[model samples]
Target chain A: MTVIEDALFDLAEHLDHPGGEELEATVLRRINEPAPFDASPRSRVRTWLAVAAVVVVIAGALVAIAPARRAIADWLGIGAVEVRRVDRPLPNGPSTHTVPGSLGPTSPAVDEGLQIATAQRRVRFTIAVPRDPTAGTRSGVEVDSRTPGGLVVLRYPRFTLVEIASQGDVPVVGKLVAPGEHVDPATVGGAPGFWVAGAHQVTYLDRSGRVRTDTVRRSGPVLVWVAGGVTYRIEGLDRVTAARIAASVH
Target chain B: MHTMDRRSDAELVSGARQGDLDAFAVLVGRYRVSALRVAYGIAGSEAEDAVQDAFVKAFRKLEGFRTDAAFRPWLFTIVANESRNRRRSSSRRTKLDLQVRDQPQSAGAAVDDLVAQRDQRRRLLDVVASLPDRYREVVALRYFAGLSESETAAALSCPSGTAKSRLSRALNMLRAQLGEEVTL
Candidate 1:
């Protein structure tokens, strides 16, 4: 190998990445073993046996079930934003303060004000801006770093574009759409996307994994899509207009 | 039965296919770090979850494994796919800030040389990060994860020639960015 090629490999050795100490145990536990919870001996043995049997059964059933799980996760989840068809939407009101310093009912207004460049620097993923003049005239841009992959809110005259990063398996934003709500599969920028119209519950998963219900805005429709490792949600626009604005994002 | 820890991957895979969880656990213990590294290369901070999911998925799909094929590459392909899928579904909140570990100073090594080496390493990392995803992935799988060219191709779900060309392109791009002097 050339010196540069060798250097590349040598550099990789020193680059700090996560250690795999817990990984083997975690993977094994998920696949086979039951959780070693503290319990009375008699019950523990029963529980162990029961859970072991269940694990065996589940292990065998996983062949049939794993694909179904992937399909469901794929269908309802658009990267960071997941849309669940719930039996009933949360009471149509602004979200109450459930946790200390949790996001209250108000949506985009909660972010600390910052310049667009500063916000861009603070985030790992690229911040896409709509090129369309109608949606491009940004009123403000704010950064909320409370989530793993920070959240950026770009306010326009007619719509709000909220970008959240999906850095892990955890769902960053969860939307509960009721039976009557309009939830349709969409294609934006040649990538799969979703369009949700009408009232819905928008919950934000905080850094600590707490669910913070964002206020339900009955104002207009919302366009959600995952492109280039970021979930983009545009609210307050019709489907065609939202698609156009989403396409203009670069 | 043969001792589980020292058994070849093929042996463990065969045992695991026959419903031996211990054999699979041994395999998990062996490949967890490599899988995590490959996953992190693609999925960033989400590598842990992606790796865990990949292993579970691999376990479920072990029935389809070809007896003669290498296991690590097959497993890595799943890791790469799991990471990519999760990455596609997720967006970033935190930047992937990779740091170099502090190395013990060599006996009588010049301070200036050490500083220069550190600077070069940092520049190399920056350039690698800036490369397009395709090129970046090849560098990651081949050099970072230490996969062989064929292994990299298998993990990428591409032909060996494609992997070879991509790695060459990636190296050329790296050399172009870092300049030829660094190579010497």
Candidate 2:
């Protein structure tokens, strides 16, 4: 681990933002004042990002969409995504129903709620698929992909995907879960805790480069599984983009 | 457990959204340091300006906040963006006064060395200033400021994956830029 990581964990154990209430009062006053979108902070950055994205997109769409490529052309690793579409359609896959399992984590008040472990793993993965840009589909893919990658505990999650062969020359990995069809166990937590076996846990291989045995549990999307911790989510982007994102995980 | 009494972020935001200055104060109290750090990292020249601008913008647009969302990320989004803008417009550099290395009243400890370390951080900030805006933002957030992947994503208004990817690339760039002066 780098000094930053070590120091961060150490700091997490001792997170105390010490200061003055006068500052908070000042902040409160500022937030309540009226402002326009163009005059807002988000608009300014969006304007810059939009300009940059437009400029970069024409010359390097492949790289522009590739999240990690921008960071790691000579970054930590050689992140390459080959999301090629296969002419031969993929075979039929299993199906499942998903709803907004937004009940956060199981109650800490309940003694039998999700039991959490304290071990940490260096998480890494590559998401290599793109869903429609609709809010629902995009949200689902992004949340699910990134969920298990960060610090959180996982419960039983099921995924049934029909292989999506790319029309263009790109290598797609992992079966793409269908629209409105989500993996079973939803994510949980905001703290730095790892899921023992989370719902719809996105499995990652270890140092040995072998797909680890995935553990899926039996409860539905009950906060009962999350153990009241912070769960990070990863949504799926285009296949090429997914690969880039995955490769960037240190 | 504190969960029962601890109100949800949505609840807090709702109260703040209604012009409950106290509730908004709570939200601000909850996030000021992180917000300040984001501003300080990006707009050290006018870090305070970036911070004030972000808080003002957030309050002004309180009604637009989606009720179900968490406040930290939303607040961070405003702060992060403002930091970027401040950086572009403000040329003033942050003069970070190093915390005093309160050493034990012993003779063997190299207290001078600790002071040197402080200077190293100050120099490190200079090195950081030399980096591109994107890389600088990521380094400040991820390492110095200490934001999580999701938090950073919320602040940047980008996806978590995008945040991580950018952070990784940025860190690598920093490592390359500072060479041996700064270690990851």
Candidate 3:
């Protein structure tokens, strides 16, 4: 019992718990401050003003979508991925269902999706496999070749990895993130990336800007990065595991 | 520099109850790291704010604190509550990342052995992180915050027996997953 207890403490020491900074000053400062009035008219006015400012900003972004979209795509572009901040609520309709890898009635790409060997042979770039120990053997693979270079989806037991080759001045993959959803900067194999947490919409676009309805789905937390001109989207894993796998991709 | 005060927590608590801000400040300095650890386990990124809030709340409610009771556990209860509240309101579970130690392996250690140990530690961390919130909370309060079983129970608002059983169950699960690799 003592051994296990001591071992637990040793392990706890390695766990990177945050809040290492000196907090005494902040606590004392807050204590010295007067208590806030919860329902004061002044507080309510401040709240409304903040909400009004957010509304104006969101409205401005929406109205500027045409020119803003391209600039955003270029600014946030990592290899073939285009990251866009969308202000509207995610569609609640059955068309944008949460069931991942399932194609809609109108989309026929699922039928066209190929096996791993086939996907590897069909794509121009190398189809790298995740080398993380827990990644295990890929259960299956799906290839979508609507663009110049194909998009490959590798399905693992615990998560999914999607890869797409870089397209110059055009994005083969698009991520539309809503307000409050996080798209934190990350690094994959020494290359810049983005980690999107919470529910967000992912869209696959062709050279002509046509949405690949079959690949469209609302995704969960995903780590997106580009290494060797291949944009990789690892989904359904925590950021740390995703990063480990991302670093191990070969 | 101001002279260091060697007063016990009881003395500080007593002084704090009598509106001695300096006494409370010392108490804060002593327990801030442990309080933050508990808060971080629950609230993640919002832990800094949560810890500060917990300390303030503990200060305001100092009058109710019994001098006979252990100060750490009592303060931990408030910290846990404040952290849980923050987590509940945010509705986002921030993943905790375990860092590698800065020190190198011993001179006799082989590269393969170092790699194996690192991998084992990563797997252990993953298993710990994946544990259910209830089990994780008990483990965090006990191991991470260095709280005793009774103190963990006090912080969690549960019986000491419950805390003990939960720790046992959590350890068993870790052992089951880790197998012979877990020396403990």
Number of the top candidate by DockQ?
1
Candidate 1 residue-wise lDDT, A1-250, digit = tens: 8888899888877675675577777776555421111111223233122212101111010111122222223343322323233343345554553221123443332455577899998777898899987775688877765444567888888888877664433343445454556567677877656677765555333321223334323334677776666667788788889999999988
Cα error of candidate 2 at position B6, Å? 4.6
Candidate 2 has an lDDT of 0.41
DockQ of each: 0.27, 0.11, 0.22
For residues B22-85, write the lDDT of model 2, one tens digit per residue.
Answer: 6666666666666666566666646667777677667656767887787777777778888788
Candidate 3 structure quality by residue, lDDT tens digits, B28-121: 8888777777776666667788888788878767656787999989999988888878877886655554443444778998988777766656
Off by over 4 Å in 3: A38-250, B1-5, B94-119
lDDT of 3 at B176: 77
TM-score of chain A of each: 0.57, 0.18, 0.60
Candidate closer to the true structure by TM-score (higher is better), 1 or 2: 1
Better candidate number, 2 or 3, judged by DockQ: 3
Reference-based lDDT, each prediction: 0.64, 0.41, 0.64
Query: Highest TM-score: which candidate?
Result: 1
Judge the docking of candidate 1 as incorrect, acceptable, medium or high. acceptable
